[model samples]
Target: MPQGSSKKRERQYEHVKDSAKKRGASESRAKEIAARTVNKERARSGESKQASKTSTQDKKSASQRGGERSHSGSQGPTKDQLYAEAKKRNIEGRSSMNKQQLAKALGR
Candidate 1:
């Protein structure tokens, strides 16, 4: 819900916000996630002028981008995140492991 977002981006933000809320994210956190998601998508699609360098160059989806940065803060890595890292590292048996197991295996 930041300023200067297009109508399309605003709709995307609302959808993402609701989805995050359904997944049990706090209100403010949901808003933040939604805003970031919409902004990143806008950047990827060249719909926004305020694109990040990484956002412009990265060919991956928003989910993939989020996974890469999920561990940067206090929150633990998500399953998708651990899987992505494991995939990058070419770790064996990663596909079969759950989030906790993957975290343990990755020494996170």
Candidate 2:
């Protein structure tokens, strides 16, 4: 956090950093994620001297987004990821199912 960040911002940063680490991010990556999230929030709330257009104008806060955009590549989550979820859910015929079918079966 930058100098003079409030207690709330400090707590939010720690929370985000710990959550990222729990989700398998490296220590540096986790800290980066936390800082970005906290900074965006600070900008949005006018707590910071400078703010970016996107940071202030985004429709959803970083905390509210809650990874909604994560793993959303050009094709979204990979076929293997879909298949693994299908297997975990005991969806029948998962082995024979194509990526699209697996996604549909899993209600993705």
Best by TM-score: 2
Which prediction has the highest lDDT against the true structure? 2
Q: Which consecutive 10 residues in model 1 have the weakest lDDT in total?
A: 68-77
Give me the overall lDDT of model 2: 0.92
In order, candidate lDDTs are 0.85, 0.92
Error of 1 at 61 (Å): 1.0
Q: Candidate 2: which stretches are off by over 4 Å?
A: 62-108
- Relative to the true structure, candidate 2 reaches a TM of 0.58
Record all residue pairs in model 1 with backbone atoms less than 3 Å apart, i.e. clashing.
none
